[model samples]
Target chain A: MSHANLLSPPSSIPPKTALSLSQKAPLILAASPTSSLPWPLSLLFSRESPESWTIHENLFLSSLRTGDDKSARLTLDRMTTRFGADNERIIALRGIYEEALANTPAELEKVFQGYEKILREDPTNLSIRKRRVAILKSLGRPADAITALTVLLENSPTDVEAWAELSELYASQGLWAQAIYSLEEVLLVMPNAWSAHAQLATLYYLSTPSNITTLSLSLRYFCRSIELNDTYLRGYYGLKLVSQKLLPLLSDSTSLKRNNDEEEAGPPPKLATVKKLEELATSKLAEIVRQYNAGKTGWTGLDEAEVIAAKALLDHGGIER
Target chain B: MAQPIVQTIHRDPALFWWILLPITVVMVLTGILRHYAMILLQTAPKKQALPQIRQQRSLVRGINLRTHAKVLPPASFQARKAYMVSAYQEGKFLADPESRGKPRPNPMSDPAAMEGMMGMMKGNMAMMVPQTLIMGWINAFFSGFVIMKLPFPLTPQFKSMLQSGVGTRDLDVRWVSSLSWYFLTLFGLQPVYNFILGSNNSATQSTQQMAANPGAGLMGPEQDPDKLFLSESENLEVLEYKWVLEGIEDRLVIKFGL
Candidate 1:
């Protein structure tokens, strides 16, 4: 989900939502529950709920993301006061705190060493381990980051987030098979994850088009993705792409018999089915484009770039395929 | 139809002021106290070494695959099941691999096992201490009196409990003794605790009873990891595969009305 739709601030800063989010930090901090007073006094005045701390945490990150370091520090100090500095999540926020402030590679290395020290004392600190990986990636050491992630996954194989991150890292290095494997692991853990299904379809599209099985496999996944969430833009976009690729191949195969040769691996989809899917995808894409462009209340959350891309695809396909 | 004559008991009104009200108030207060005591005694989960984590999650991974394997294709499911079954049988994911094929250590000797038991022990202490004290308090001071009556009819078998201290075999079962009231308040105050604290309060006696069971939690120290993995592997090996994407193209076409 896009942050824009949730915040939906009337202030139109489409390009730099992070800046707008950080700008709200002062207002957020002022109204948040206070923990500076002694226990009894704080208890009397505080209206603390679990969500208040989550807001503070998100605001802290947004401030850091937009380089509003002073506000970030203020939010951090407030949180540290509320939940003691020794708290695990507070500890991770502190690491991110240091990482954002470091200007040079040397200072970043020092921050890296600090994370290492924390990990050495507590190797099972999963969040800190993830921070170490993020820092390594930012320090231009993708290889080291992958190794760190592999170690983390070795410990916690069921961590869906880590698997997704490893897939991204592998995809960045053009290791398509590893990326697909990691993504499949993510799908295994969360079978109904529509976004992961869309992502896997995207990966299959990127990795290989010539393989006969992958085209049908990608089609099935895109179909599953849309089946899971009919309104998912990426799923519809992928379905449109796959059908476009399959149209020419399926057209000339009428004289040739549809082979039932592949027994264990699933049979390739029929041409008539492919054509129907293609038409469905095109019409759906057009509807989504029209609905999202209408600026209705619920449709405001669609990614502007994606809706524009869908519009372009529809226009281009009318000319070519 | 014959109407049954309703028996009546006239007790001192002072009994309502002193014994009945105080017992009810004390029971409610102790429930609130138990809730806070439980919160104070709960220890945060301690961190374990990487190998230990791998041992735990590897089992979780196997179980998840078995349950959710229907989502994957037959060939992919076969590959994963084959690999997991082989790895589990080999004891490759064991936290202490040297202990493979050996019997699990006795719970008394394992410190980790001892720690889990200690946590349960603390909860039991919280529950049992208040219970004994309150029962003893009621028996010592407020025995041999009938303070309150139930509005509904009860079976005659309750006469043993409802008239325990009164030494009356012929008294109506409608008359309730102080000990019986203590017992009633003990079991029946759960809703009051739920109202005072939230619904998920630890003061509820049912949850304490649940926590006392040996096999209460998944993958607790009561069960060894090696056996858990082996059984999970067997379960995965026997699991039938079905692809969720089976004939999905037809479904999509029908869904979109193409």
Candidate 2:
């Protein structure tokens, strides 16, 4: 399952990868279209891998991403001919194509109305529903976008992608409880998503009253995140914060006794445990920062923004500061 | 006890070229035909409305909640369990709440159900038609002849099957008739097809037929979602929950040897 993801458009395409992928768009288009004829006729020609269509789809997206609109248009045309313009997913892709090429606010609005028209005709097309949400967000109507996204979620509650987007929207609006609930819904669907665990931990950390109860929740979640993926820089950075924050809280025996009085809430970790975890996070963060700064091969995939942020956290010293 | 007599039948060597060979070749070719026919018959999936999607996904969401409740914190888990139990009991997530607790409509009356049945029927037809034709052909043309002998020994139970057309009760179980050869090729020509048409080719009947039961009926028109929701609710209620994050710090410290 650890595929190279040549079939699907990568969620976040690095500049180097994006350029390399867009460069292949012409090559794919030049392959002169594999047989789309049904079975027996299809058998006469060079067999098409099921991956070919998805590859073309991804190539189309990457071509758009890298501003190769000519190639993107060609790929889009090829796909439209194969899948037809009326196909639901292709219609969404075409919408994205228009959105990317729009020069002014008016054109964007036109694209928005087009999405609305499609939705009015067929309200059940989930892809168009999502594009409408995107358009509304880009148009600076956060309220409308939220409503659109919620409607999308109501139609398909198991869509972890939509749930994550909902969480992102709520987090941006500073609605901590709703944001956390959306993320928890995401975790409910995909429990072992380490990034999601880390994201939820961050929401808890950023929420008001960084109390012992909340801090400890963040601490365990970050621990779980790193447990799932030790190399995760954000997990290490968040762990460094919570484990340090809990150090002083755990040191005070009176605070421990106070926490113990709340029988339903679990006991916080011992002071020594917190100290060890804090040291572990600090060392791991330092190592990651060092290796990443040295331009090491394995560490190169770490997001540049994240590596810098980790470096800043390390430089800022501890919570006592 | 006296040694059982071996009933050896002398047959012309030309029978190998004329009878056994042609049946196997035809069986293999027929398999290839069926494979292509199946591919041609495959229908594109039909899209569902948003409400139906919501209904199906709601059931799935509850199943996901039940499946991964252990990953959630105790409070979150309890809250979700309570809400899901209540929602399921109330049948709040049904695509059409009016259909709740109602008996499923007869499959023949539902067009979607009818389409599904038709696809299965087509698959059966694709399988059954050529087989009965070939079987009848072999019976009419080659039935009276004893065709081939097995190198290895077999039990007496195989006599009824392997010596089908020949009425002799006392023939050695290892000697097989032409019809039995056809039966043998029907079950065994997959590797030959794989060599010719590639491994995933639907030329093989036994293995391919088993795989052809398309999950077209996945939460199909038949099931009462209200019942599914209730059962899922009970499943969630009875789940033994353990939060993965509990004591995760100690596990991490030990893992990193800090």
Cα lDDT computed for each candidate against the true fold:
0.83, 0.83
CA RMSD for every model? 3.9, 3.6
TM-score of each: 0.88, 0.88
In model 1, which runs have C-alpha deviations exceeding 4 angstroms? Answer: A1-28, A31-46, A252-265, A318-321, B1-12, B73-75, B211-217
Instruction: For candidate 1, give the lDDT of residue B118.
Output: 91
- Relative to the unseen true structure, what is the C-alpha lDDT of residue A122 in candidate 2, on a scale of 0 to 100? 91
lDDT of 1 by residue, B1-258 (tens): 878877677788999999999999998889888887887898876667789889889988998899899777676778889999999999999999898878878889988767877988899888889898988988899989988888887899988877777788777898989989888888898888888666778886687666555433667766788898999998987887788988898998898777
Off by over 4 Å in 2: A1-9, A36-41, A248-265, A293-300, A318-321, B1-14, B167-173, B194-220, B238-240
Cα lDDT, model 2, residue A198: 96
Fnat for every candidate: 0.90, 0.81
DockQ of each: 0.66, 0.69
What TM-score does the predicted chain A of each candidate obtain versus native chain A? 0.90, 0.89
| Sliding window of 10 residues with minimal summed lDDT for model 1 chain A | A4-13
Best by DockQ: 2
The worst-scoring run of ten residues by lDDT in candidate 1 chain B lies at B209-218
